[model samples]
Target: MSDEPLVRTVRPGVRVGVDVGSARVGVAASDPTATFAHPVRTLARDEQHGTDLTELVTLVEELAAVEVVVGLPLLLSGQEGEAARIARDYAVALAARVGTVTVRLVDERLTTVDAHRRLRDSGVPGRGQRKVVDQAAAVLILQTALDTEARSGKPPGEPVTTGGRRKKERRR
Candidate 1:
């Protein structure tokens, strides 16, 4: 919290955003200029068969993304919970499979809730939202990352190295 804002130097390239949920995985991608993010797709969580991760890895490769930003849902108290743990695991698995592309986790406290609100505000119905809420949330997550990197002159979140989860107190 400084009076002077940090000027971040962000690389210009395509970045992918992921929102990992218990039932579905949302995917989003930024433009090559790293300007805007839009929904890519939603994959059914297939932990049993590992299909979700497979598809995600393929998608990232296809997009030739420079970075992959995964949403880490932290509790309002700035603490980790089951959902956070799940996201971390997903990121670890993704990192192992994604080759050189980097995976970073950004705090996503209420992106899903906000996405729902945005969808509703945009006239998307409750029932219809179930199919795309995750994607909307992914968009918010990626846009937030892009904005953070541009404003703070730093990557938006902690990078997920093959070693494992990066930090515990991200908010502080």
Candidate 2:
């Protein structure tokens, strides 16, 4: 028999992952037990009016998500670029809107690339992959976060607590 250990749920509540792109934002949700992450839907980015954030708030309340993991697109060398800055700002705004729910930023170094490779390997043609690639990437990001949390026995990623000690941890 295989020797892989079964992954146990660390914090028993739903978690959501978000992949914010130029035009579309991909969303994913974990089960109540946080054992599996699955794609929910793609939303058009509304940076001008923040309609996307409103929808996200509704989605979070509806799913009763305990945490929201926003993908921070860090470079391979671990430097923050424009994309990372955008993600950080978005996470802050999301945290402001979500009230007591936690919003965290996890480094998303190669999630998009890995998602593309996985889709191609799974026989999903290139033409159809673009439509759903963001969602797939969100799934990868959330699954990785969940696994890390379970293994480390702590919540994964930097908690985006604006005006709090955890937010100050961003410097570290």
Candidate 3:
């Protein structure tokens, strides 16, 4: 198989957004036209790696998602810090988990903050937000990516390559 990351065409179709966290993963999906993203559900992270990935793969299959967008949490100054590294690792694992499906890592600096604010404004108590915060963040991540692609005529962010290579490396 080619080691290069898959570059999916920027078109209208169902897309899934993922916000990976230590304990929970938030999932969101876009409409067939890719106009809006809505929260799907929050999934618990299994302690075993295989089980976690399996759940994600099952979700992908069930959604028939054309592309999977994984949020990359970069620093405010655009640097890839430790959190970014973890996100990248998750993206690579996720890409490998769901073979043939495109996984893109979009910059998601303030999506979590936005999610929290939205939940607060909507009267979701801080105590109860944990159950759905990840889903809310996933929605923001996907919506931002969809909007970016629509405005630029290009897919937002970089695709996550399978195997162990980084996205910046070119296959020789």
| lDDT (CA) per prediction | 0.91, 0.89, 0.86
Show pairs that collide, candidate 2.
Answer: none
lDDT order, best first, reads 1, 2, 3
Off-target runs (Cα >4 Å) in candidate 2 are 1-9, 164-172
Show where candidate 1 strays beyond 4 Å.
1-8, 164-172
lDDT measured at residue 171 in model 3 versus the true structure, 0 to 100: 15
> TM-score for every candidate vs. truth?
0.90, 0.90, 0.87
Worst 10 residues of 1 by lDDT: 163-172
**Candidate 3, residues 1-172: lDDT per residue as tens digits?**
9898655445867899999888888999999888899999888887475576678889889988778899999999999998899888888888877766788999999899999999999999999999999999999999999988877778789988876554442111
Give per-residue CA lDDT, model 2, range 1-172, as digits (tens). 7699965638888999999888888899999888899999888899999999999999999998888999999998999999999999999999988878888999899899999999999999999898899999999999999999888878888889676645432110
| Backbone clash tally (model 1) | 1
TM-score of 3: 0.87
Please write out the lDDT profile of model 1 over residues 1-172, one tens digit for every residue: 7898565567788999999999999999999988899999999999899999999999998998988999999999999999999998999899888877778999999999999999999999999999999999999999999999988777788888676444222220
